[model samples]
Target chain A: MNLSRTARALLWAALAGGLGVVYVPLLIVLLNSVNADRTFGWPPPGFTMRWWAAAWESGGVRDALVTSLQAAVGATAIALLLGTMAAFAVQRYSFFGRESVSLLIVLPIALPGIVTGIALNNAFRTVLEPFGVSLGLFTVIVGHATFCVVTVFNNVLARLRRLGASIEEASADLGADTFTTFRLVTFPMMRSALLAGGLLAFALSFDEIIVTTFTAGAGVRTLPIWIFENLFRPNQAPVVNVVAAALIILSVVPIYVAQRISGVEATTH
Target chain B: MFWFMPDQEAAVRLIGLRKSFGPVEAVSGIDLEIADGEFFAMLGPSGSGKTTVLRMIAGFESPTAGMVELGGVDVTRLAPFERDVNTVFQDYALFPHMSVLDNVEYGLRVKKVPRSERRERALAALGSVRLDGFERRRPSQLSGGQRQRVALARALVNRPRVLLLDEPLGALDLKLREEMQVELKSIQREVGITFLFVTHDQEEALTMSDRVAVFDQGRIEQVGTPAEVYERPATPFVASFVGTSNLISGDAAHAVLGKGGTYSVRPEKLRLSDLDAAVGADEHSATGTVAEVVYAGPATRFVVDLDVGGRLVALQQNLQVSSMEVTELRGSRVRLVWNRRHEFAIAS
Candidate 1:
C-alpha cells in the first residue's frame, strides 16, 4: 500500500489525463456554443448568447427535441416491461437453455450498433411493409428498445439475485397468494432497481444516432439525428453547438437520478 | 394436556412423505403424527431432510409422494397461502422495505383483517417476543436478534393451526441463540400452538422440544422424548449424533462386553480412574492407554486407545482435577469403568 511521492504524483497525473481526454471535447463544444465566431475559430475571439437564441427560435430544434423525448420514453417503457420479466424468468426458475436465454437477451447490447441498425432495418422493411407499417418513430423506438432492454435486464437481474426468494416465500407462508406476494413484497423491493434501469434506458435511447438513422423514415427525426444533420450545415453549425451543449446539460438529469436511486439501494441493501 | 380430550385431533400428520429433487431424494419416506400443543423438533445434520419435511408441511414444497395433514384434514395439494400453517425461515426473511410493524401485520392484512385489529395483534405478538418498541424501524435498521423476533412475531400474528420453524435461531450467536430458544419455547406454551421446529443442533432440540425426531440420510432414525433419544438412542446414527457415544461392536463388543452385536455407551457414563481400579460384578471395565486429553473448562474428555481393539472417549467432570493434572494423564495407562446397564445394544 505504501507508495513514493513520485509514484502517487504519477497516478494522480494519469487520472487527470484520462478525465481530460474524455471531457475536453465536451468543454470545447460548450465553449463554442457562445463563441460568437460562426466558424468556431479556436480561442473564440468573443462570446455571445446569439446561438442559444437562434436554437430556441428554431422550430426544427423543438420538433426534434419532442421526437427524441417520445422515442426515449417509449423505448424505456418497453425495456422496463420486457427486461424485468426476462430477468425474473432467468433468475427465479430453472429451465432448459436458461443460461442461453440470458446471453441472448444481452447480445443485442454487445453487438455493434450499426449491425443491429442494419439488421433491424431490413427486418422491419420486410416484416412490416407487408402489414402497411413503415419505418418511422415507432420503428425507431422499437430499435432503441432492443439495446435498452439490456440495461434494465442487467439491473433487475442483479437485484433479484441479491434479494433472494426467501422474503417472497415468507410472504406466501404468511397467507398472501402469488400475486399478492409479488405486488406487496417482490415489486416494492425491485422499485429502485427498475427506476435506475429505466433511467439508464432512457438516457441511452435519447442519444443513440446510428440505430435511429436506420430506423427513422423520412418523416421521423430524433434530436441526435437532427444534431448529426445540422452539424455539417454552414448556416446551422453554431445552432447545432447550442443544441449539443444543451443536451450535454440535460443528459445529466437522468444519470444523476439513476445514480441517486442506485446509491440508496446500495446503502439500504 | 390437550391430548386428554377424547375428540382431539393430531395437530399435524405426514403419511409416507417423500421428496426428491432430480435424482437426489431429500426425504425418502416419512410418517409422523404430532399431538396438539406439543413442541416437536425434527433434529438432523445439514442434508438430513428435516427442513424439507418442514417445508412440505408448510406447503412451500409439495412432497414427491405423500400426504400432509393438518388437524386430520388432508392438505397435500394446498398452496402455502391456503394451508393454515406459517413458517419462520432460518434467515428470518423479514421484508426489508417494510417497517417491523408492517412486516408482522402482513399476514393479517392478507387475511383481510381490519387495520386496527391487525395493528393490535401485531403489537401483541411483538410484545410476546419482547420487541414492542421496534415497530417503526425497518428490518435493515435492526440487529440480527431483533429481525429474528420480527420474523417470529410475523408468523405468530397469523395464529395458524401449526407453526413450522426451520432453524430460526441458527443465525444468532450462541448466547443469543440460547436466550431465543427459551423465549420460543415459552411463546409456544403461551400460544398453545403446535410447533414443528427443525434444527441441526442436538442440544437446541433437547432443550426446547417435548419430543424430537432424529433424521439421517433422508429417513427418520428415531422419534422419542429428549430423554429417550439421548439416554436410549434407537440407532447408531442417533447414538453418535444426539451426543458423544463410544461404539463397542464386532471384536470390541466381544472382547469388552463378552457379546457379539453392537452396543453404545455414552462418554459421560464411563468412569475413568487409575489402571488398578476395582470393578464390581455389575460393571464392565476396559483397560487402555490415554491417547489424548481434551480440557473443556468444566469437563475433560479423554480419548482412550483400548487394549480390546477399539477406542473409547470418556468424559470426566473436572470437579476436583486441575487442567494440568488432566493433561498429564495423556500417555498414561487407565481403566474405563461403567455399569453394565449403561451399555445399550443398538440394533443394526
Candidate 2:
C-alpha cells in the first residue's frame, strides 16, 4: 500500500525496460528508414527518405505486394465463409466425431506453422499433383485458407457461444427460413467478429512465409517472401528494412482496428 | 393474419416429449398444451427441467422422443425459425453489436420484410413496450429491466404466436423482478400471444400465470391453477414447494377421517386455547412452547416446540393479532389455532 520514491522509481524503470525491449527495434526501423548513414544504430547521423523511394522503385517488391494482397483477400474471404459455417456446426449442433472435427479445425492454430506447411506440401505433392492439380495462386489460397480458418473460426465461434439461441429462435418464430435467420439474427450478431476475423486472416496471409514457401509456384512471390529473399542476401537492404517497416505499419493498423472491432473484453472462453 | 397473428390457439402442444443429454434426462415425457393468449408458467427449482421443455418448443433443442405441435401443426422436426415461436432468454441475448432498433427488427429483416416496413413495425413494437425512444441505443446501454423489455419487444415485434420467456425477470433485483412480473403479465395480455413462462420463483408463478406446472426431477409433479396447486397440492413435493407449511407427524390411520392423501394440517388451522387446558392431556392437540418468534413486519412468524411432536412454524398475519398481543416477546407458549379445511392432504 505504501512505497518510497526509490521503490516507485524502480517499478517505473522495470516497466520502461520491458517496453524498450520491443520499442527499440520499432524505433530502429523508423530511424533507419530515414537514416542517410548505413548502420542500424540508436542515434542517426543524418536523415533521408531515399530507402523508402528505393523500396518503392523495386518491381519485385511492388509485384509481390500485389500478389500478397490478392492472395490474402481471396483466402480471407473463403476462410470467413467456411470457418463461419464450421463454427456454427460445431457450436450449435451435436453429432458423431464432433471431438475429432473440433481437433482438426483447431490443429492449424495449435500446431507449429512449419509443421502445417510441411504437411500441406506433402498432401499437395503426393495427392493433388498426381491428379494434375496446379501449384500457384490456387494452391497458395488453399494454404492460406487452412491457417486463416483458425482465426475466422475462433472469432465467429466465440461470438456465437456468447450470444444466446433466443435471438435465432425469435427470428425463426418470426417466420424466417434457415438462410433468413442466418442473415438476420446470426449474421448481424457475428458481423463485427467476422469483419475482424477476415481482416486478421488477411493479415496472416500477407505475412505468412513458411506455408507460402511450400505452396507458392513459379513467379508467385509474396511481399514477405521478397523481404525474406532480399534480407537473406543482404546488400544495403536497409531498403528491405524500410519495406519491413512499411509492412509492420500496415499489419499493426488493421490488427488494432480488428481488436477494437471484435470488442472481446479478455479471453475468448 | 390479423396484425400478423400467425393464427390459432392451443398455440403449442407437447405430446410425450422427452429429451436427454447422454445419460441425463433433462425433460422426461412431458405432455403440455398452452392455449393462445394464456400465460402458463413452469415453476421449479434449478435442474428441474423446466428450461429444457422451453428449449424444445423453441427448436433450440429437439426432443429425443415425441412430437411438438404449434397451431395443430406438427413442428417436431421444424427448425427454430420454422416454428412460429419467439423466446426471451434469461440473459436477454440482444445482439450486442446492433442498435436497439436493429436487435428488435432482426426477426423481421430475416423474413426479408422491406426495410421501410421493418423499420415501421419495429418502432411500433418498441412503442408497445414503452421503449419507443430507445431505437438507436445498444443493449449494453439499457438498464437490466430495460434490456429485458427490449428482448420482449424484439420477440414480440415479429408477432410470433407463442412467446417463450425463460425466467425473463430472473436477472433483475427483487424489487425489479416484482415490477417486471406485473409488466410481463400486462405485456402478454396486450399482445394476446401465448406465453409459456418459466421460472423457479413460486410467488411469481402464483401472481402471473393462468396455470402453474410444478416440476421435480424432470417430471411434472402437479399442474393446475395457482389456487389448486397452492391450496390443494397433490404431492408432498408440491405442498412443501409452493409455500411454507408446518408438518405435524401422526399415525397415518388416525390422522384422517377416512383413507386419504398424507394427512397434514396448516399452522393457522390448529386449535389451541383455554379449551385445550380444560380438555384431557391426551388430546390430539399437543402442547407447544414458543421457541422463537420473529416480527416480520407484515406478519409474526413463530417457531413453536411441541412437547408430543417436534418443532413447527406458524405465520400469523399482524392484521389478525391485535387481541393476541403479538408484541408479547419470545419463549411464550401461545396457542396455534386454525380450521381443518385449511389443511391440504399431500402424499407421504
Candidate 3:
C-alpha cells in the first residue's frame, strides 16, 4: 500500500511537472499584462487595467484584429468544405491514387509550416503574377487552408471509418439519394468532429505567424504581425502583453468547446 | 394514397443475379422470386452469400450478371436510394444522432411527404414497434432491444414492398432474439408485406419464415417450408445443418442401404420400447453405457456411449411421473436404437 501510494504520488508529480513547464510561461505573460509596472517584475508589484485599455485603443490593433478574424474564419470554412468532401471521396470509394491523395492532404500539415508558407509565397509570385492577384487575405487564407485541410480531413475520415458503410446503405435502401443520405445520416453523425476540426483550423489560422509573415504582403497585417511589429516599442510592451493575454483567452474557448463536445478524454472507439 | 398502391404481383424478384468483388464471387448466379406478402428467409452460415443476395436485391450492391426487378420492373442498374426497398441491418444501423421519430421520419422527408403527415406516419410506425413514447430519445440512449425496434420502425415506416432483414436480431441476447423472432413473425403477419430475411441461425430461420432457402457455398441447398425442410432435408449438408442428428455408420444390406449410404437419426426419434433383433440386432446396433444426463426443464438430454460406435445423444420428454425408462446415470449399461422410418439416410 505504501509503495502504491508512493508510485501514485510520483505519477501525479511527474504529470504536474510536465504541464507546469508549458503553462507557467503563459501564466507569467497574463500576470505581466496586468502588472502596474511596465518593466517585468516577479509577484507583479500591483495589478492595473491600463495596458488592456491601451491595447483596445491602439490604432493598428483594431484593424488587424478584424482582418485576422476574417482570414481565420474564412480559412476554417473552406477547409471544412473541401477537406470533408475530399475525405469522404478518398475514404469511401476505391479510386486511383487514393493513397497519394490521402498522403497529399496530410503532407501540408506534416511538413514544417515554414516550408508550406515559402511554397505558397512562391506560387503566388510565379503562378498568380500573370493573373494580377497580389498576396493578401486570399494568399494567407490559401496558405493556412493548405495545412488546415489535414485537421478537418483527419477528424471527418476517422468518424467515417467508425460509421462504416451501413447507415448510408440503409438510407439509400429507404429510397434516399446520395445527397439526402449525406444530409440526414452522415452529416449528423459527423457534426461534432467537423465542428472540432473547424475550431482547430480557426485557431491555427488566427495565430499563424510564420506563414502569415511570408504571405501577408507589404500593406496587409494580421493581429500576430501587429503584435510582433509593436513588441519592440518600449511604450507599447504593456499593450502587446495585454493583447497577447486577450488572444490567449479568446483562443482557448474553441479548444474547451471541442473537448466538451467530443468528450475525447474517454478511450476512442 | 390507397389509390396509389400497386398490385399484389409487384413483389421483388431476382433473375440470374451474380456479384463479384474483384476476382472473388461473393454471390454467383442465383435466382429468387418473393411473392408480395411472403415471409421468405435466406438461411446460410457466414460467407454463404446470403447477405450479399439481400444487398444486391436492395440495390446496395449491383448484380454483375442478370437483373433485379420490383413490381416486375428492372432496377438492376438503379442506385440503392432509387429502389423502393428498406433493410433492417445486423447492427441495427440506427443513426446515433437522430431520435427514434427522426429516424422513422427520414424516409418520409426524403419522399417530400408533408411535415404533419410525416410526423403522424412516424408516430404510427413507432407505435407498431411499441416505441411510441421514445420519439425524443436518440438511438445511443436506447437499450439494445429498443434500438432494434427503432430500426424496425424506421424500415417499416417506408412501407417497402420487400423488407430485407440482414440478421437484424443477431446482436440481441438469446431470450430477446426468441422474443423478437415471435414479434417479427407477428409483425410480418400484421403488415402482410414481403420479407427477405437473412440469418445463419436455423432456429431463427425456421421460426419466422413461411419458406426458408438453405444456402451453402453460394448455392441454394434447399428451398422449402420449415416443416418440409425439417422432416425431409434434400441433401446431407441440409440434413446435418438443419437439425441435430446422431449419425450411425455401417455397411447395410442392399435392402437397408436402399435408404441411403449414411444413416442418421434425430435424438428424439430413438426408440427404446423394444429390443427387437430386426432393429437392434443388425450389424449397426449400438450398445453403450449412459455417459451424461442434462435436465433441460421440459426435456432430458442423455449422452449414451455406444459400445459398437461413438457416443449417441438421446433426448426424452420430461414428465412428472415415470411413463417409461426416462434416463439412466453414468456408467449404466444401455442399448440405444431407432427404427428405419425415424432414420434419415444421406447420400454421403
Score chain B of each candidate by TM-score: 0.97, 0.89, 0.87
Local accuracy of candidate 1 as per-residue lDDT tens digits, A1-269: 99999999999999999999999999999999999799999779998999999999999999999999999999999999999999999998999999999999999998999999999999999999999999899999999999999999999999998988998999999999999998999999999999999999999999999999999999899888999988778999999999999889878789999999999889987
Q: What does DockQ give for each predicted structure?
A: 0.90, 0.42, 0.60
Selected candidate, larger lDDT, 2 vs 3: 3
Model 3 DockQ class = medium
lDDT of 1 by residue, B278-301 (tens): 999999999999999999999999
Candidate 1 Cα errors over 4 Å, as ranges: A1-4, A41-48, B1-7
Residue B305 displacement (Å), model 1: 1.3
Q: Any residue pairs clashing in model 3, and if so which?
A: none
If ranked by TM-score, best first, what sequence of candidates would result? 1, 3, 2
Best by lDDT: 1
Task: Estimate, for each residue in A114-201, the C-alpha lDDT of model 3 and write its tens digit.
Answer: 8877888898999997899988998988888988888899988988888898888878877788888878888877888899889888
**Model 3 lDDT per residue over B1-348, tens place:** 775655755598778888898998888778877788999999988999999999888887777898899988888988888887889998888777677898899888889999999999999999998997889987777889999999998999989878889998999999999899999989989998888899999999898898999998778888899988887777778877888756655633233334336666778876433334355443344557778877776887778766555566888777662424454455677666665566665666
lDDT by residue (tens digit), candidate 2, A1-269: 89999999999999999999998878777778888876655577788888889888988889998999989998998999999999989988888998789889978877777887888888888898989985788889999999899899999888878785666665566567778767756776788888888989989888889889988887799988888888866564777888888888888887998988865533321
Model 3 ranges with Cα > 4 A deviation: A1-16, A41-47, A96-100, A118-136, A264-269, B1-10, B245-263, B272-313, B316-336, B344-348
Clashing pairs in 1: none
Error in Å for residue A11 of model 3: 4.8
